[model samples]
Target: MRFLSLAGWLTVVVATAAPPSVELQLQDEAKQLVVRVEGQPAMAYQFGDEFALPHFWPLRSPSEKLLTVQRPDPYPHHRSLWIADKVQMGDGPVVDFYHSWKNLRRPSKPADGFRHFIRHQRFSEMKTEGATALIEIELQWIVDDNRPLLDEHRKLRLVALGNGAYFFDLTWNLQPHEGDVKFLSDGVHYAWPYVRMHPQFSGEQGGVLTNDEGRRGQAGTNDQTARWIDYSNTVAGETEGLALFVYPDDTPPQWLTREYGTFGPRRAEKWSGTKFTLRAGESLHGRVGVFVHRGDAKSGRVAEHYRQYVEDKL
Candidate 1:
């Protein structure tokens, strides 16, 4: 069994060597995940993990404890969970559903049929060099249906920097998914207390889309493509991160952008305000980057990091 424990550094001392990835250990008292960046010297807690958005999204029932933090928000964004146990499967320990409240796809019961395991989830990632550290992570997911099972794959990656911040990166690429494309939802959430208290330093913005029904065959509503997301934050650390997307094949209306944070993001007349469709022999992909650094939202130095990521990928 695979278990993901507190994957973070202990002290807040920056390192003096090359950078390497590490894990963060959440300090309940501080109510913040401590990070140690190797190259960044002027920033502590330069980047933080998922600051939960409480009021908007449900604490996800039994999935609360497994989550890191939860606050309230207006609409769209809702809540976020730093998923370390759910998808890890046999990599560490089995999910507890309570204290270790993990979110995963339980075997299908005869009566229920199938459903989406959880909406969108965020996870933490840390990289360090001696005392220095970098904190980064990525949160993503897609609707998983239980109709004969076609094909699917999703991955989350994080990079810790030199100061005491983090950068979490996630990649979600779904292929040959079987089923009718539906609507999508996306919005914003306030980490309520933390964000409300430090509004000038950190927050988030989101966007999503769904597909149509008529086009729900092997060539659903949209086609293959991607986009760019620059993270300008109100926090410490000047070097932020870069994110993008890539869809190699399919149709249009570019369905699948999440506009709301709900169990449903499809083309139905229910919660979501969108719809989409897809079929076999199709592929879709996206990339997003979050740069962790020191400063306010207006002066956040994320452009430089975006350039760095572009060059590194090339």
Candidate 2:
């Protein structure tokens, strides 16, 4: 009989073990939704009023390593994962919802430029079954003493994909509570979904970024178009990262990736000096995918994942 080393036996056991199970725990009073994989805390959804919008922070990979930085300095607006933008109601002046949280202290701003807040109205749905968890919420975008501008419905589904990976599908719908609203941006950045990776995963720290279009790094990737982009780095002696995917069914959102470890989609340049409307009584929809895995782009099978996403195989 052949005798295997202890380490070898352990490795085999780990490899052959059943995939990790995922559990989502909702802490309503704490205003957080926690996701656990194989009994290890994996991520959290934050919907508290501490920020201007709802976001996910402290995202982690299968290695239990944090993959996102929560409210980094100099850019506290850069949440782990969020959506917001400068917007206007009908012909009204632009309201800086994206960065308005900074102006919370200055209570005397003009009504036209008043800071806005996204208040979590309620959790419409929260359920966990098998290897997936689903969350849905309703939010009110308000300004100037509870003046509502928009109503948003956000839904997220997290699935355990095994192999040190998890997948999340997100859908957001916005409707003008008053009248038509426009999402506008003056610069190269706009209101959209984004992620801020942990400093350990910054491109300056030996991390790698790749897009479906074959572009590498933030130098030539920012504001570029791609179906998806992957940002990978090593942590705790293991390689892992996150990838953002833009579903073909939704509007083609441009990449707002960075080398310092931020990834997002922007409509600013796409709507520079112009704006699109979320008509009254009509909802504008946005869909996206987030993949957390344990490897670099190729090693993580990024393309295969994208194909699965577009083909609805996931």
Steric collisions counted per model = 108, 0
> Across residues 206-283, which tens digit of lDDT does each residue of candidate 1 receive?
211112122221123223122222222212323222222222222211223221221111111222233233345554
Best model per lDDT: 2
Question: What does candidate 2's lDDT look like per residue over 57-125, in tens digits?
Answer: 878887888789877865877788887777788666568777765446464643333356787899899
Q: For each candidate, give its TM-score against the true structure.
A: 0.39, 0.87
TM-score of 2: 0.87
State each model's CA lDDT, in order.
0.29, 0.79
RMSD to truth, every model: 15.6, 5.3
Using TM-score as the measure, the top candidate is 2
Alpha-carbon lDDT of model 1: 0.29
